[model samples]
Target: MTEAAARRAPTRAPEQDPGARGGVRRSSVRGQVLDALRAALVDGDLAPGEVYSAPALGERFGVSATPVREAMQQLALEGAVEVVPNRGFRVARRGARELGELAEVRALIEVPVMLRLARSVPAGRWEALRPLAEATVAAAAAGDRARYADADRAFHRALLGLSGNGQLVQVADDLHRRSQWPLVTGPVHARRADLVADAAEHTALLDALVVGDLGVVQSLVREHFAGS
Candidate 1:
């Protein structure tokens, strides 16, 4: 892998919120707005069950409502936001049961694929991903909510990308983003320690991949989701 690729953060480009920049293409602007909104949702800037208009978000990001609306439409598809009939959109509120189900689906998809990758791929390939994983841990430790969210997404995306299935990586990345959206209730239950612990799982997961023990990999995958 290229050194720059190895040093890349866990989150994919489309998932990054780089703020507004001038002279960008319309399509790219929409993506940036979407990423910004998703980061807001994960960072608790967009509270659950609260309606936010495109124009308001536009003001926040210094863009027009058109792109903001376009971005929100994508988020609506991800179940991260729901469009109001007359209003704009409200953040989707997922309860404990829904969270559990989401976690189950993630495990169902990621575990087997990861296990297969562990068996087929060389340990060095997985080892090359350690820098991205370490970036995630640093983000978690720093307590920058948005950065941590992006790094966490990047780490998992990179991990799953090792399986060499673009479609699987796409789906798993979507699920990961959905899982990170803040709940309707005020304040996130996952504190700094929780984030630190979650970030630490990347190392353990990488170690398991290097060890290539089916049983160990299986246990870690299951326990990781259970803890989530």
Candidate 2:
């Protein structure tokens, strides 16, 4: 072939990089947007029952509307938001009754697990979780609701993960996330004192578990869920 003709062959489109198709990159952006949206929900930045447009959220996150829409779709699937067709998404309005029901269900599933772990798992294991518990306290002390929520869930997930039951951990994590969402009315944001108090419970619960104090563990678990 002539050299000119060879140069005109366009180099076979450079083998079409996989991420260039928007698969990996788009998925990463969507995941980030989803996480940000969830944090907004937990921080009460996204008020319950209030409508939010994809473009507006995208502006806030400094991304295109496509990824924001994709993220909102996932949130909708998780019951965190509802579609509004041609408008935007509306954050799900959870009432006191629903929150109470979630707390009760969580207590039912987690209390027994905590009690079992307290009796069986080594004191060292419980002690090892001290960092996670402390992380919650640090986040709470900073008055960062979103950070506290993440730390709180991480601590609980670590605690339940000791049960060696993957399904149980997943179920409990879902309920925990739902419970962190702000309610439709009354106390949209947690006071710094309330957050600090809640975080302190983690340390106290860990202390109880470390010493195998089943009674204290049980009491703390119930009170934690009740106040949550």
Candidate 3:
């Protein structure tokens, strides 16, 4: 290799590809480890306040300790997990104020970006959004708290897809994934009516998108996140 090539950082040195969806490319052992660990973290497979055993997790993912250690290090950097001294990685704890701030920052970054990506928001995008929003509404109506939360998460993910910036979508996902901590802190059992109302508000946001109403859409986003 030339001097310049030698000086370059070996990003893929050990066969890890953290590439985005489409080229999704979750092919290598390291990539599999990272993706599995990330899924477990984000999907509440490892619940809030649940301590993760590095070796146990490695066993479940069918890998050895080394890659699990590396993945845990990366997750810690991403704020998905916390590194406790001599205790390995633990799920990060968060409170209501922190969750609300996360949603606020996501709105601040994403609303404008979504407005810009409005042209690509496709005429049929609302068709895709409707079912997810309805699923949230139905879950809320049925008083299924966990299912409601999952549906709520799906609604946000669909909204993130509106931005069309693969990287930016992950920023919003990171913020929301951290939200589950506080999401269950309150009386979600008593909040079904409120959640249903939130789903209806999403309908309005969908309508705003349809009409290309940037101001109203941004306002709706702020209001929706403010209650978090």
Candidate 4:
């Protein structure tokens, strides 16, 4: 197995062995494969528009093709990949325009909510999200795109969750995930310094919100989405 695949492999407890619980073991393997595939997509390990067979991925992960196929089907549903008849799955080809649209939609939904939160939510509430913001910075500094993506989403989710609207959070999260997909024609991985700068924006936004600076909050939010 590849080192990346090895790192992503799930460790089973003795009682959860395949022999003792075949179905549970399969499900666990499938879930791990799904997560690994998503990480691969975010990290640009899976090239856009390229078809990849389950057996090929299975060999790389040192697992049977069944779990890989199941995970690819889930990715299909997520629009991360598409079925290719009898061949395999092709990584979805996302372009700059699609990414820009996703960012626009996110800003439409989140900007107003954040502005409102800045006015109503206490400074302590904004302060509480500092750890999550810092996590993104750490991940960016480590040059780990997958980890940075996860941290970025967590920070946004937590910030949006403050609205107390489950549906809004779900919608915003979907948009956020799509925005993270790499563009097919440009540099897949961002420069480490760019990642660090982007991560710093979270902290800057929080600082603006804490001080009840609506103008600064609005400007930061719009500029952030524009950069996305």
Candidate 5:
């Protein structure tokens, strides 16, 4: 665990608005835009503390300011970005205390949730996660920023059933986007040997969860943050 990552607090939960939120059924234009942007943030294409404008984004998405503003509001509520008074929004700043608090809250939410998910954290699911996990490792090795970031998050998402709490997973998504985790595992450090260690830890968690080893799983989970 790096001293830097270990010190981040939980004040700024970053955005996880990626992929499609409302599905492709065309529920609302704003919702879809929000989903795409959130996914971008989670994927690290949109780094923490990056500033962007709603109008420009709306134009880029072939929409208007209304949906863009609405989507930004939803993201703000999720703690991904902050809406400046006159300025649009900027990715929340990262700090030790902020990340620590985020980690603490996530632990509170996920530990019990995962405890409950113990029954459902099956081998079949582990098998499914294998490919994602392997991809993450490969990304780390190859220094593929985009692939690593997306694959890393996907591996976590692949376990949505393990936590058995959709809300818990959402909470994690919200926190990680803003967390210094990007700095730790982000592409800037994609080729770092330490990141490979982090990938191994993720695999360890999967193994522990698969075997229903709560003690080890929870311990590793906490250490993941502590070591970060």
Candidate 6:
């Protein structure tokens, strides 16, 4: 095992919910642990391809191994991690090809929906989402990866929500998270300049949306995933 793998240990306790009932409280804590572990994976704190036992992860989060196992199972379903027989779990390693495929999938679902929204929704509607878009840029400028991820998800979700299709938003959100997953090699948003440039793309996308420019919007959508 690598030094990184060796250090995976329960370092803290999971926070408990005081208001909920027995099962609800357990479920709530499990969800919280799941979210924390997911964030740690995205933040590159839990090294990809490094196997970590559920007990160790549970220890780190100050939670029971059961919740950690449940969280890891969810991560496995998301393709963020995989199970190891008689061992534990390791963050799945994805390459450029997988990312490209996800980009293609996202473009197929999002582009047409976005184009339709440009025609149907008023300029003011898109303009109203300007703050959400700007928030992403601000997050990127500050080199806040977690903030950027949240803002990015919010901005895209809001934009896609303009289509008034809940299912579409859910699917797009799943693909978006996969696209943002940290590579086994490292986190993509480590460099400030790259994030700044990507942030500018958000501003440009908003411009196209506000003007209801289908051509520009389509082009920007394709270009947006080019580097991602």
lDDT of each: 0.77, 0.82, 0.67, 0.83, 0.64, 0.79
Off by over 4 Å in 3: 1-78, 85-88, 117-122, 142-146, 211-215
lDDT of 3 by residue, 70-92 (tens): 78888888777888777678888
Winner on lDDT (4 vs 5): 4
Q: Ranking by lDDT, best first?
A: 4, 2, 6, 1, 3, 5
Please report, as a residue range, the 10-residue window in candidate 3 with the lowest summed lDDT.
1-10
Top-scoring candidate (lDDT): 4
RMSD of each: 7.3, 11.0, 10.9, 2.8, 9.1, 4.2
Q: Please provide, for model 6 over 1-228, each residue's C-alpha lDDT reduced to its tens digit, 9 standing for 90 to 100.
A: 223323333344434566655667677767877777766775577776789998887777777889899889998998888999878998878778888899899888988887788788898988998898889889788776656777888999999998888999999999998887873343544566677888888889899988888888888888887777
- TM-score: the better of candidates 2 and 3: 2
TM-scores, one per candidate? 0.83, 0.87, 0.60, 0.90, 0.63, 0.86
Q: What's the number of clashes in each of the models? A: 3, 0, 0, 0, 25, 6
* CA lDDT for candidate 1: 0.77
Model 4, span 1-228: residue lDDT tens: 334435765453231365754577777788888888888887677888899999988776667788889999988987889999999999988877888888889999999999888889999998999999999999888877778888999999999999999999998988888778763334535567678888989999988988889999999998999988
TM-score of 4: 0.90
Residue runs of model 2 more than 4 Å from their true location after superposition: 1-22, 183-190
Return the TM-score for candidate 5, rounded to 2 decimals.
0.63
Candidate 2: tens digits of C-alpha lDDT, residues 1-228: 223222222221222247577466666677777877877786667888899999988777767788889889988887899999899999998888989999999999999898888889999989999999999999888877777888999999999999999999999998888888772334524477788999999999999999999999999999999998
Which consecutive 10 residues in model 5 have the weakest lDDT in total?
5-14
Model 5 Cα shift for residue 177 (angstroms): 4.1
Choose 2 or 4, whichever is better by TM-score. Answer: 4
